[model samples]
Target: MTLQPKNMLNRLLKSLLVSFVCIIVLSIIINLTAIKLPILTEASYERYLILFLYLIVMIFYVSLLFDQLYLSQKAKGISLFFYLFIMTGSLQLLESLVAQINVQPKAIVDVIVYTLVITSFTVLIFRYYGKGAESYTKRIKNYFSHQHISKWLLKCIYAIFLLFIAHYLINSMLTPFIEPYYNGRYTNILKMSHHAGDVKYVSMLTHALVMVVGFQPLFALWKGSKTSLLFWFGFPLFIILAFQPFIFNVHWPLGFRFPLFIEETLIMYIHAIILVHLFYVPDETHKEEELVKSKLSLSNW
Candidate 1:
């Protein structure tokens, strides 16, 4: 509820400004050190322009989340810090692992520097001057309480598998459209088409877990309905995940971007919808009623 179209300027501008300032610091670091990320393409003015726009959009996405979760809801700074760090860091590390990109310690350090810069700025500025997490506390206490330990594990496993299926299904269905765009442009591309033991699943597993962590605070703290969560939370997330990579690698035709966007965003929104549903644990009033519904089920048998 705190993040409305009219009032989003408060959150969006601050985050972008902070990220931009931090990016300058990061650019300086790259200039000074051997630290580099794995972008195989040479830079051009047009490519740099695209990169610039992508970074803006990416920063806006992150800031939107920061506003909804921490600034508007008053979640803890530690939560924000860890969310930003782990989400971005895990993405870098996992991509390096799965894509088999030859990432070095310097690349990791690059991620760390940017993560810290953005996290510290948001925590200091927003936590200090913002409305605070009164809503976060009230919403969480009102929403969920006791849950079965077994149910927690089941929820995680159930969500991860289903999320992976959604991701795989989308990519597989769209590959016909996307493969044409591959164009033999970049041999250094990801060959993660669905296979028996593709490493992409590993990335999906990590994504599912990270998504769960990210979802919890929002579900508990956000004052919006599931639809708002989908738009505010899910849409922005998928946008960044879908488009951020296109920022660096300029070899592939822009043709793939749309289909790939469809694939990534489609799966991600499904992910958010699933999380929203999965997290809808029974309150105390229905806890007993909701449990053990089937007489011929495994438990009864």
Candidate 2:
């Protein structure tokens, strides 16, 4: 399947902007109305919101990659819908796991409801779609052809901000996990199959690695940059350091006392930033140049 044509780019761009605005509005409403919503208590609602945001971010990222790799709108659409379904289903499964662990049915139904919506979307995508499968890439040899220092610097600064948020999140989650590893019960808990506490820690750490390192690079590549040379190498190193909790724990504290509340919020923002960057930035540098060439030729004619 080929990626969507240039004609579709404008539509995708608009959709992304509108979706972002909607997300922000929703966040504001949720915060303002938090006390009134029985279903959205501070602690439980925060977790639910994080999971919800993660699912949306994953959908956007996977769809962009599918578009790049398959080169067809139909394929991209289907791939996105399918990924959302699987992710939602996985969240429900996680709820089930957590329920079994804690022996409580706390906040699982909300997750299931979200999962159902994603499944329905998947069905819609599979019904009416036509496209071919092929690899599509834009080759632009010179990104510096039309230099705008202000815009370039703004984007770079935004990227740096995202990296910083990622760093903070990795530190916050890992420290608590690390503390447990150095305790006397560590070996026994590792051997035990039913240590839900340890499971939660390990799961978060592993998913953080996947999201920051694995998913983040695809987002970077989709933005028409050299993923391997720029982000892929650097991100893995960061992830490795962040994963220090899984190894040794008897070390000096890094003083990562960042508030958990803010940490969760920043992670979602970082996810959104990465996904938004990848979606708006076409991987083929040649794609824009080709359009410019076509226009010039028509003018000459």
User: In terms of TM-score, which candidate is strongest?
Assistant: 1
Residue lDDT tens for model 1, 1-301: 4557755786667656665676566556667876554442333456545555555666666565656554442345666656656555775455344433334555667667666766667666555445544655666766555466687778778887887788667767886875653444444554434451467677767876777765676666655444566677666566555555555555545666566656666776787788877775444444554454433365766
lDDT of candidate 2 at residue 71, scale 0 to 100: 37
Predicted candidate 2 versus true structure: per-residue lDDT over 33-137, tens digit per residue:
422222233435454454344334433333334444433555445444434333333422332232122212333443344334443443333232335444333
Give the lDDT of residue 199 in candidate 1: 71
* Per-prediction TM-score: 0.71, 0.32
Query: What's the lDDT for all of these models?
Result: 0.60, 0.39
For residue 280, give model 1's deviation from the true position in Å.
4.4
For model 1, what is the alpha-carbon lDDT of residue 71?
45
Model 2 misplacement above 4 A: 1-74, 85-113, 119-197, 209-261, 269-282, 286-301
Most lDDT-accurate candidate? 1
